[model samples]
Target chain A: MKRLLKTVKNNFLSVFFIVYIAVGMVSVCKPQALNIIDGFLQSDRSLSYLIKAPVLKLLDIRYGGVNLEPDIKLKAFYIHLNRLIQRVIGNDYIYDAGPKNDVVRLNNGYLTTCLPKLTD
Target chain B: MLFSSTVFLFAFLPVVIFGYYVIFRKSRLLQNIFLLIMSLIFYAWGEPKFVLVMMLSIIVNWALGLPAAKYRDNKVRARAVIAAAAVFNIGLMFIFKYLIFTLENINSVFGLQIPVPQITLPIGISFFTFQAFSYVIDVYRNDGEMQKNPLNVGLYISFFPQLIAGPIVRYQTVANEIKNRKETLSDFTTGVERFIVGFLKKVMLANTMAVVADAAFDAKDAISPSFAWLGALAYTFQIFFDFAGYSDMGIGLGRMFGFHFLENFDYPYISKSITEFWRRWHISLGTWFRDYVYFPLGGSRVNSKARLVFNLFVVWFLTGVWHGANWTFLVWGLMYFVILTVEKLSGIPKKEGRLLIIPKYIYTMLLVIFGWVIFRAESLGAAGEYFKAMFGFNGGTFISDDTVFYLKNNLVMFVASAVFSLPVAPLLRKKLMSAGERTRRAADAAYTAALLLMFVVAVSYMIKGTYNPFIYFNF
Candidate 1:
């Protein structure tokens, strides 16, 4: 009996970790839209920008003129934070942009003009 | 089956795993027979006719291996047998993969009317042939005993996991495991985790970057300096993750079957020099060449400069040509050989201590990024154009809105690939393993959960996405 108690004492942190992850997951699931946004931002850069640009625009409404560079940083933070949310929720809700809107083009804009038109 | 395919994940793997475990509970001999049948089925799924070619090679090598083992003491006869085996393997490879290229070059040079024969190159031919040849050579050299059982030899050659795209498991590495290996619960768990991580790396990371890489490489002359760099960088990561991911899957599947395959990659992107990069990348193939090809030709021990140059040239020449029947691949291999030779000749002191490591890594990365231009280009001329574009040599007016848009879209995936390509997971695992009891348990739990989540997402992606064949399948 004493040995069992001692074992639990030794792994107290693990117990706490499980509880923490569980609670975080529950909190994440409550706001499905935010969870989805977070999941999308985790892997999809274009989708990340779509979410961030609008949110930053709102923040700019309150703050009165946020610098473009700082807004980029803020957007990155949002994406990172949402990735954490995704891990906690254990669900992926990220929307995939269809093949029509090429994600590569968004990531590498310098190639747009030089890109060849597909005829067939 | 390709590692990236839905059929492989959803259909083949699950069935194989369940069937193997169900049979394994009955008898060990039954297990081997089950695995052999499954392997044959797997190979036939892709190329039904070519499986015959694989079987023919396996039968010849197995027969040769036994006799070579019997006459191991007769150096002359053994040498002749080994030579015949090598020629047969290499000769078949040449006819299938290089016949067209050889004929085209001959026609161009001699003004002949010889037409290039069209042939569909068999997938995984190079990998399986190399594995088969190595077995015979090992028997001839007395480095390992020939498997008395033909079934064991057959399993080693066509072991489905690493057979298609390989770290080229040697005859010696899995010789014991072929007869005796017991999988524990821990082994199965770790195997599942490894497979999950590899699947995510392929579906999530490598596939994402491949989109951009294909667009940029296909763009050819129209690609701007920035766009070309991005494309090349994406491809560099894409190829590494794609191949590394497949290797991890192969290794993981091996572990699940109670085999312990050697690690094929060790954070190759983190390499400090081109030499170090080669040491870490495709470690099995490099070691194979070093042991079988380099050492036999007198290696670096020879006093003659000519011999030294010859050994290096042969190793690199085979290395390049081993990848494909393309001039670009040959140049890519030669480029590495030149860099390695210069580094050796200069006698530069190896950088020591922590501070200099970053600079070394950056330098190595730059060299690798440049090398990918040759690897990805369709021809030598196209590779030259791509390299020139990388340096902003084509009048710097190539940047366009479309390029910026693509960059914007793929930015997240590109960055993720770059980060994950390092030794982050292994480093974390090491730390977790060494930590206190409580911390270790927590880390284990987190790692397991993360692996499970990654597996779910990866499978979901696989189901939705088109099948992408492994890059090295051609090699």
Candidate 2:
């Protein structure tokens, strides 16, 4: 009991400092993660299509076009970040599909593909 | 120069803090001078031309106040001086804020071909003018002595922190503090903590919600009923956090400068009725109006029923006009007046027990949300459309992808905002302080660390450029 009390008493400030550092690190890292995710969302077609599907489904309730869940955007953001990390470490995780429905292509053609699909 | 701006956090604040401590740490007079210069620069940074207007108002009020101070028994002259000062201050505010509205109304009503003149409304004109106006009135009323030092009076009028968006510090409230106040270590620490909490609220929560609210509000036609409700709810939270965050920062900064300004917001969301809400929310402005305007107009003391109603109308009208130049603001004020009048007539039932808390909260929240729709909408038509959408009149779906997207992206932040908006810190401190020495020590350590973490994150957000101006700066 004494030992446990000692641990709690002695390490309290240290534990707090660790949490502080972790929070600071996360704060610093979040924007970089967001930027990378944005890039991936811009590049991959299948991923983009998979993400937009749910959003498009949701958009049908509105004027039948504005489907895009904040969560899906966040997912796209994370996926993009993962891809970015892979790129930075020189791992080619982003597969280049030649000319057919890539995430990049799908994303760029989102208005045409998603809007029509929702209306139809 | 806004408290939430990146330039303010990184450049302006740091420099001001350093300069203040380094130059005027020991001397109160020197500190006041330094603050005045900094405040002048801050105001001039936004509106250089309006600085002259502020100066003119200050000089006029100071001059008016001086005569009233000297003539102790001359009631007629004292009344005249007060009247002149009030007219000039209110007149300037009217011309700048409401001239365009007046012109448009005239053109529509009488077929007058009056061209709307382009006039830039000075930020915080209403606030500073009210402070100046209050000072002169107080002097005439002999509630407080007139400030002998013009610079101190100038500082009171233009104190940058609360000048733009205010707790509307009455001249009398800070009169003694202006002449004599000491900055203590404890006060400084508390001030820093308060500032950090406010900063976190604005950057982490309010701004995030603002993005969704702005987008949904702008694209109203495409918005679902659920989306519209979400947007309104988001805006309700957003404006509270934004304005309350500003008031916190202002009060915190006031403390840092060894001044104790009045609390602007209590747990206003916890209020049960519109009357209770007014008492809690914008307490400073409400008190100022009550003391300066309402009581002087005979308040509820007048014998005739018509006179009492007329008094309420005048107070509400001026209160509405004080908020902004728009007819919407006027309508919003009148709406409150009508509701309060109704509440007064049909008396609120006596609270039976704690079980009523939930219903009361819901009641207040609903009223506040409707009020905010009026506040947020560009015009009455848009407000009506938005209100209709909220009720699903357009047969819109319950949940949209955009709605989910906003929720998902901001979920953590929204949760954090909810938790912090309560008096959690103060409550925890109170509990710990009463428990034992060890617990108190632990609480202090935790609080300090949390403050430091918040500061770093707030700075990071500012650096990343997500900072937004406080919502009430335009008032």
Candidate 3:
């Protein structure tokens, strides 16, 4: 019983630490805690920003300090090469297939930038 | 140079290893001299003037450590010498690393217009400083003998394998190996295997994941919860493989030179708690801080509770600042400190045992994934926005075409990374060892073939000029 008393006496201040942090977090960090969690779970108040986000993102990629135009060009080349492979396979009678996800619309920014235009 | 670079893979490493074995096989002196010169060249290639800085560090630490050894009987003089060594080593890092941070903070706080020094941080300043600290500290503690030769000390500090991004090698750990070590055929073979695995981890897994991570993080579109989660997950794995992979390469390179280095990481992701996570991750750094910093602060032997708090605070605060001179990094370290403190006080919830451990894993991984979100962000505000998007706070669609496309394309790579992040390779090795002799030999042969194939693929990736800078190299 004396030993238990000594142990508790020694750790009395240590035990208070848990309480101190709990109170500090609640008093200082508590207000934003729920709001932060809410931001994560609940939807934001806008439908207009949806399209703007991707455009800004791509802009960041293009002009975000590190130049990656070569990498972007390479990615475009790979996509085109993939389509060519699909077309070659489509020519085989055993693997006749409809074209998909490869229609390079001239109006699209990505396509216009990444592909050679038809020069009639 | 990056291990995954073509110059390193096809040119530098091959030439260095070949010369070490073929040309300098007879004399250990020639090998040491050769390694020292090559390491200096490797460092100088990046920062020509900063190479002199490293040499100065080596000379100063070497000079100081020898005297402390000489005056071991005189306590005060020895202490002062060690103290000077610490100041010089740490002072060098401070000027290069924290000078800009200090000036900016002072300007912001005091409303002063002190021009911040536009010094480019010397490469590997953080890593080498800690490694240098270990040498002086070890000497002070009388734990290791003072190295007599300056070349050996230089080799210990500027050892190329880990000189840049470390599993910070201790002077004491490789003290004997510096002067006298054997380069056996088996060690050489083992080193090749380890290097190949590390190379593949960086080139194949980390680099590919980095592409996905960048795309997701850089997206200006309203982030769906799915996309946010996926990017964060990819980043989490990218960082692990990138750092752990570099450490593996370092250890492998050390072995090839007949200097054995300790393993820097276990599988940290498999950890059940943040406390356990630190135990498993960047093990050398954790141990270094513990031995050099924490223990010296009367770790766990605190006479008072306040003292214990002070000790924990110091260790963790230093831990955070060690990563970078950013408030976010400081907060990241504090975040761990708070959780670790809480866990230490309240103790983690029960059911920590193996049976029904799945929930623990889920809890741990979710926290880790969240932590990575904070660590990878440009600022706290950006991190805040990201957190919201992760939980679908932003009024955005739960799915995007980009997400679906990336998921479909990179699903195989993701699955492979998930498998590799665990101990699948180690498990396979365990099974092979327990099998019969013929089975073990077959497994070894197949493993050799696999490493060779990975080497070829990694070399191709290097030739293609993938973004191959190690993430931790910035620190």
Candidate 4:
């Protein structure tokens, strides 16, 4: 026990930072997880195709809406964040010429569909 | 990635630190490999394509370093090898950093429309290229051994802490440590303390000053004289804290991993002359130029004054051009060359007079502040306009409500920045040390607590997504 205490005292900074960073990781990564899920669904990779249809079916959500069913307030926040990200990535300038695809128009006047944005 | 960013603070740094300390604790080679991979990832997080450019630099420089070392006994061949390395690195820098600037200048001068390609500069090109040069040159000079492994070369040049913005670690400084080093608990704690101090300096002081500086500078022609001066002063503190804080964090991170990089700054604001200021401010770059450029050109030891002047001119010209491909930076460098030449000839700095120190300090700081004005301006014309306002020649008032408003809002931060720019904290700690053993113990505990508080506050600022602009990242 004394040896344990001595080790902790010697490596106090390492201990402190490990605990602090663990707490920080949870705080910072939670929102990012939601964003990553959105990215996977929107991405053009073949792996994304495997879960895209079933996940959307399971959640019973529109292609444009937030998934993973975060709380209503959290979903609103995530949508706001998604819009901001879209604006930053120049997706806002993209306009829908026709609506043949399974598309939904966001209030921000940008199309929100599983298909890749025309800007890309 | 910026040290002040939440992603770097919470995600990138923690993961790297965990892997460094825990997973690879027993193996030095594995730790070095881990560090190199993580460094490349950290750099590529911003722009993935540039990783190719960096890898090209590492492989080529490492390849050159081998032959440079091999041919050391043959003077001409070794010299040729080092020259080739120099040209390659400089050519790479010129292509990415200065091709457009050079083309545009030529188009204007020769009255021909030369098509300039739009080149997006890879961040830290200046820093890493210089490190690559340092490695080859050091190996040739026998200051350090040649690394047989290309990954070790990559690790030295792309060490994430000092990679993007640097204290520009010399190759000789960490050559042995790359192969053999031990991380101690004491070094870890000290690194933590130093990193926290840098984090607070950057997030609290530099970012706050940046807001005021940006407001006035962005206002451009309409600013009052008082406001113009306030902007200059704000920028003065902003840059010092930003770059120095970065260097501190880099040094701290180096310590955590058991690499002791040299001090980059030493309270330059307290200098009594431009010469002293250069010695104190950005000591790494200054020394790099001195050892690599000036000393090779015979420095001040040339017998003829004309030769000495020529050498100084070349060094200063390159120094100016080294900052960026900007007329303002060039003019700023030349401005220093002129002042430094005058100082050297006049023997002003070495003169002994206690009463002269105050004026000497004011003179140095004023010149520095004006230099920063030139450095910070968008162009030479904009700098002139700003100076006109600063001198009340732009038809602007001396004192205005806007100036007062900014002053009042930022007075606390300004005062704190000014105080911390000196050696006050270190001096205070010194005095505390001499008081008593009990007092010293209490002081140590208080210091640790203060560091903890500062870390929490700095991280809070990061979480809040504050105004964090790194000035030296451009260079």
Q: Which ten residues in a row have the lowest lDDT in candidate 4 chain B?
A: B458-467
lDDT of 2 by residue, B329-401 (tens): 8888998888777776566634556888788778878988888888888888888888888887767577887
Query: Which candidate leads the pack in DockQ?
Result: 4
TM-score of chain A of each: 0.24, 0.30, 0.28, 0.28
Model 3 residue runs over 4 Å out of place are A1-120, B349-351, B354-356
lDDT of 4 at B262: 93
Question: How does candidate 4 score on lDDT?
Answer: 0.83
What is the Å distance of residue B13 in model 2 from its true position? 2.4
lDDT of 2: 0.73
Highest TM-score: give the candidate number: 4
DockQ of 4: 0.11
Model 2 clash pairs are: A37-A80, A43-A104, A44-A103, A44-A104, A45-A102, A45-A103, A45-A104, A46-A103, A69-B405, A70-B405
**How big is the positional error of residue B49 in model 1, measured in Å on the Cα after superposition?**
0.4
Model 3 per-residue lDDT tens digits across residues B332-413: 8898888878776667844457765787789789888888888898888888999999888997788977678567656766
Supply the TM-score for candidate 3.
0.80
- The positional error of residue B302 in candidate 4, measured at the CA in angstroms, is 1.0
What does the lDDT read for residue B402 in candidate 4?
70
Q: Name the runs in model 2 displaced over 4 angstroms.
A: A1-120, B349-351
Clash count list over all predictions = 25, 10, 10, 0
Q: Residues B1-475, candidate 1, lDDT per residue (tens digit)?
A: 6766634554456557767887566777778877888888788766678988898889989998987998788888888888889889999899899999889988989999897778888889999999999999887877777888888888999989888889799888887788888887557656666766777888877876776788788873566788888889889989998989999889888888888888899889988888889999999899999999999999989998778878988999899999999999999999988888776666442758788888878888998998888998999998888888878887656776646856765666777787898778778889888999999988876866676556555544553344354788889
DockQ, all models: 0.02, 0.02, 0.01, 0.11
Question: What lDDT does the true structure give each of the candidates?
Answer: 0.75, 0.73, 0.74, 0.83
What local lDDT score does residue A45 receive in model 3, on the 0 to 100 scale?
A: 38
